[model samples]
Structures are given as C-alpha cells and as structure tokens.
Target: MKKPQRSTAIFLLILSALLLVAMATFFYLKTQRQSAKTSPTKPALTVSTAALEQSLLPQRLSANGAIWPWQEAVIGSEAGGLRLTEVRVNVGDQVRKGQILATFAIESVQAEVAQAQASLAEAQANALDAAGNAEKARSLQRSGALSEQQINQFQTAEKTASARMLSARAMLEVQQVKLKQTRLLAPDDGVISARNATLGAVVGAGSELFRMIRGGRLEWRAEVTSSELSRIKTGMSVNLLAANGLPIKGKVRMIAPTVDPQTRLALVYVDLPLQAGAPNDPAAIRAGMFASGEFEMGKTMGLTAAQQSVLVRDGFSYVYTLGEDGHARQLKVQTGRRFGERIEIREGLAPGAVLVTSGAGFLNDGDLVRVVNPPMPPTASTAANPVPTKPQP
Candidate 1:
C-alpha cells in the first residue's frame, strides 16, 4: 500500500508540472496577442518653421508714464480790473493768436482816455499860441518896442505852455495802452484749456485766467526709469495713445538731463505729429489729456523670434530646430529683450538658420516632424526606437 501511494504522488506531481507549463504558454500567447492589438502608432506631426536672419532689435524697458502738451502756455490777465465780456472761445474751443478771448468793463478807463485826448487837443492849440507869442516877444525885444522884462516874461510863459502840451500828449498815450490791456487776447495758436474768469468778476494783473496748449500738435511727457532712460535718446521713434483711443506717432524731442530724485524717473518729451491727410484746426488736442507712449530706442543686434514661437520646459527655454536630416531637433536657448511681438534670442542661436516657429513645446529631442511648406527636406535622421535592456539573470 505504501509503495502504491508513493507512485501515485509522483504521478500527481508530473501532472501538476504539465498544467503549469500549459498555463505559462497560454499567458505568453495572450500577452503577444494583446501587444499586437495595441501596438503604438506614431502620427505625423505637422509644423511650421522660420529662417533666422540678422535684424535690428531694441533693448527696451517698460514703465508707467504721463502725457503733457508739447507747448503748454498759461493764459493770464496782463492788466487788472473787472471782466466785462467773455468771447466765443471757451474750454475746448479753438483760438488763434491775438484772438480776443475776454474783456473787462473799463468805463472809468474809457472816460479817462477821452479826457486825456481832450486835454491833449487843448494843449496843442495852446502850444501854437505860445509859439506865436514867443516870436512876437522876441521881435519886440529886438526892435526895442517893448521892455526887456516884458519880453522875458512872455518867453517864460510860452515855454511853460509847451511843456504842459508835451505832458498831456504823454498822458494820452499811457491811457490808450491801458485800455488795450482790458481786452484779453489769445497769446498763441492753441485750444483753450481752462476758463477761470467770468463776466462781472474782478481779476488782478498777472492773474491766471485760462491755460492753452500752443500749436495744433500734441505731445507726451513719458516717464522712464533711470536704467531705461539711459537706453533712450532724442529722436527715438515713439507711439502715443490717447484716452479717447487715438493713436499718434511721434519721436523723442528731448530727454531730461536729471531724473526725479523721489520717483527715480526721467521725463522724455515726445512730439506727436498730426494725422496724415487730416485737416489742421486750432481745436486739435486739449492740454492735460492722459496719454501713453512706446519709444523705439533703436535697433538692437540680437536674435529675435515671435513671442508665440518660444517654448518653456523644466524652467529652461527651448526651440525646435530642423536638423540636417529632416527632423525636429530640440535645443536649449537663452532669450533677452522683447519688443511688442518679437523676442530676442540672446544665446544658443545663429543667424540665417531655420527653426520651428510654432509648436515647439510639443516636441522631444530628435522628433520626426513633417515640415509643412519647407524649402527642402532636412538632412538629419529622425530618432530611432529605443531598445529595451534585459534584466540580469
């Protein structure tokens, strides 16, 4: 019985071994079938590329700034008295140089002028009479027909009358000039900025009445940081935007010699030209309207790319370049200055080299890419399939 049991155990062990082998074969076949069914299929990636070319770029710094008129002139009263009349020009109205803006009621001044004119006329007639009298007195004295004392008295009286006539004429001229000052005139061609005086209000001499921006052109006082200020110079190209969405082109007219101590900003004055083919009018731009500007310091010699074409991965910048064998070769790059839409490549790039302009982020090193509309097929080979390494026995 013990011998039969041992033989039975051995037979069972052999059957178990056969079953394990069959199970192993089934699993291996199943794995192979699944792998065949789900093999990775590579889809062709279409991309666009750009050729690198040497061009001018600018080193720019951005900062907040304000706008001011190119030629701001404060309108002030030159003569004291009451404001009697306001003219057609007010805030936002166009005015020409020497245009009457306002007037002060000077009834008293007018009366004084008339009085001085009358005094001048009377003095003129008296002076004529005095000349005749002096001539007659001198002739009488020469002929010995009148006493010397009498002739001398007549001569002194004539001289006194002539002096009075001259004084009266001087007074009349003074009154006329004063009367003209009562009418406020526009000092320059400009738009009225403010109207501080009203009819029936008294104003003192040198009092500020209205502010005007001289000339029809506008300007912007752009504030730039100390570092940025150094990069800019007079005559740099600039673009100006107004609060009302008006875009104007300009250039730097001047740069402040010293920066503001508190703000650490320097003022760059930009002169905005009138729109081409636009009619010139006095009411062009108002003073103190808010404006912003972009100044092109100049062309900076650096590699540049469109802002969308750059890629960032793992805290490093990268760009896809077409290698010699028609594949996307990823390269680490360093970038510098940025203009509106173009960025400068500071390092890791060469001029006149073609690179992937878009879709650089969706690529790996040595990726196989179909260049859409390329000039010619690249000479570089695509990446090869990675082989799996066998485990140690």
Candidate 2:
C-alpha cells in the first residue's frame, strides 16, 4: 500500500509539469506570429528609372514590295527557219549593246547570198553589153551600117537591161541583210535574265531567244496604304532590305497617282543604285525579289522612352512605372518608330512618368521595387541595341 501511494503522487506531478510546458510553448508561438505579421516586406526587384524624354524622332512609314527591272528587253531572231548553230551566252550573262548572243547555221543564207551575187554579176555584164551596143547604134544613127528600127530596138534593150541590173542589185542587198541576220545580237546593255535559244533546233522569225534587264537597272515597287501615300514624296530617302537581308538605300522616284481598288494600296517606285560589282553578282539584289523598307518622313517631336524599357507581351506593348509607394505599376504603351536607343511613346504614358528602364520583366504589379542610378552607357562600337540587364534586389 505504501509503494502504490508513492507511485500515484509521482505520476500526478509529472502530468502537471507537462501541462505547464505545453502552455509556455503555445504563448511563445503566438508571440512569434505577431512579430512576423509586423515585419517589413522585402523588395522584389531593383531597376533603373528614367524620366520620359521628349525628343525629335524620325517619322517612318513601313512598307513591303518587290524589286523589278526598270525595263526588260526581249532579244529574238529576226530571220526565220534557221538551225541554231551556237549559243554564246546563257542566263545571267552581262552583255554590251550589239553583243552577239547566238548564231544560226549560215550555210543556207550564204548559199542564197551567193546565188543573188551571181545574178547581180550576170545582170551587170548584160547591162554593160547592152549599153555598148546602144552607144554604137547611136553613133551609127546617120550611117547606113544600122537600120532606124534596129537602133530603136537596141536603145530599148539597153534601158531594160539597166533596170534589170538595178533590180538584181536590190535583191542582192536583201540577201546580204538576211545573211547578217543569222547571228543574234543583244539590242541593249544589260544582264541576260533568261535564254530560250536551243542549239540544233530550227526557229522561225521573231522567236524570243533571251530576256534581259536593260541597263542592269532595278527598281523597288513598294506598296503603301492609301493613307500612308501622302507621307511619301519624290526624293524622300528610303532604307530597304532585301529578302537576303542586304541593306540598300534608295530614293522615292515616283508614286502612283491612283490606288488599287481591291487592295487599296498604292505603289511607290524607288530606284536602286547600280550595285558596285558584276551585273549578276550573287551578292547583288536582283529583280523579282521581295523587299521591305521604311520611308523617312522627316522628324517630328514626340515623347520617348529608353528602348530597353519597352516590354512586349501578347503582342501588346507595356512598360513599368514606379508608383508613389515604391511599387511597380504596369502601364500599356503604344510604341512607334524606334530610332537608335529611343522608342517613340505615342500614347498610354504621360510626360514626367518614371519608367523602369531595366529588369521590368522580373517584376509583378504591386511588387515592391528599389530604384537605382543607371550604369554608364556602353560605347557604340562595343554596344548592343538593348543593353543586358538583371534584377538587382
């Protein structure tokens, strides 16, 4: 009985001590919860801020079009029914005016010319004999050596022979022209764009043999909307890029007087310079290549922001500005032409707005932010379009 009484007292004391320790732990946890609730929030990102700048930015109109020849010259054979004997030039060959491009078998033409020449020579001989006989008859007009009727006949024969000789000489000239036509000649200075002449094949007159870009000159026909047409003018500077990404500078040569009814687009003709190399230089832009370009419509005053500050999301332009409470507030902006390091802010932003110039992508709306001074700008030679940035805080 004495041992049982002592064990029960020890168990009761242990339970009371455990209860006190549980109460103390509950109070300590409550105090820690309160302290956590009162603690200050940490900044989510650190970014450089910039004031909205008003600058003179270039007004540009973007357009797309195709490059074409100023004029394409078609070269063909003028003489008919001749076998192609030789092809001197293929497509893309640079040729000067009157350059021989192809030749036909001259055997038939030469034979005909030889026949005509023989005929002409025979006519000349007959004419000389007739003239001599007529002169002799005239000299003997009063002499009894010739009858009057015979003398008249001789005179008439001389006139007929002379006329026949003239006819034969004209026929010879015709044959000579046909003989020269056996060779195909380039009509202009240009680069051959196509060739259709085939060796050993008989072709007729006026059959196209080759196509050339006359003068190696190319023009870009840019399509612009009707509203945008007013902004483009003759002599305005244009910067163009070919499909191969080569940059070319051009000037507006002409603008169409009317727009296409179906597309409501007008053509602006831009003349490209003679590329400084071979006409068919692989590096040079050629006719029929599509291109994109911008027209410099001069300068206009507008609000601008650092190019890096503009963010694009879901095809919408956005920028983050600092709020009075030191939190990031996102604002959608309308972006216009980009010039160098600045982008035109057409709308959705007011002047004097402080924009997060860097690391806005890592931020969320209402997230605390810390602003810092921008680092020194990199030199042009070593700089990229948009400087690399990172969140600092």
lDDT of 2 by residue, 38-64 (tens): 986788887888889989988888899
Off by over 4 Å in 1: 1-63, 144-150, 227-230, 243-245, 274-286, 305-307, 312-332, 337-342, 348-393
Report the Cα lDDT for candidate 2.
Answer: 0.90
Query: Clashing residue pairs in candidate 1, if any?
Result: 52-352, 57-300, 303-345, 324-379, 324-380, 325-379, 325-380, 326-378, 326-380
Lowest summed-lDDT stretch of 10 residues in model 2? Answer: 274-283
lDDT of 1 by residue, 1-393 (tens): 899999999999999999999999999999999998898435348788886655577644444455565667888887776565665567767689999988887787899999999999999998889889889989877688889898988888898889999999999999998899888888888777677877677888888888877765666788888877778878778876667667667788888889899988888888777441123443344446677767765565767887767888889888888876667888888988776777778788878767887676687778877777546654444224445689999
Go through the candidates in order and give each one's C-alpha lDDT: 0.76, 0.90
At residue 36, candidate 2 shows an lDDT of 81
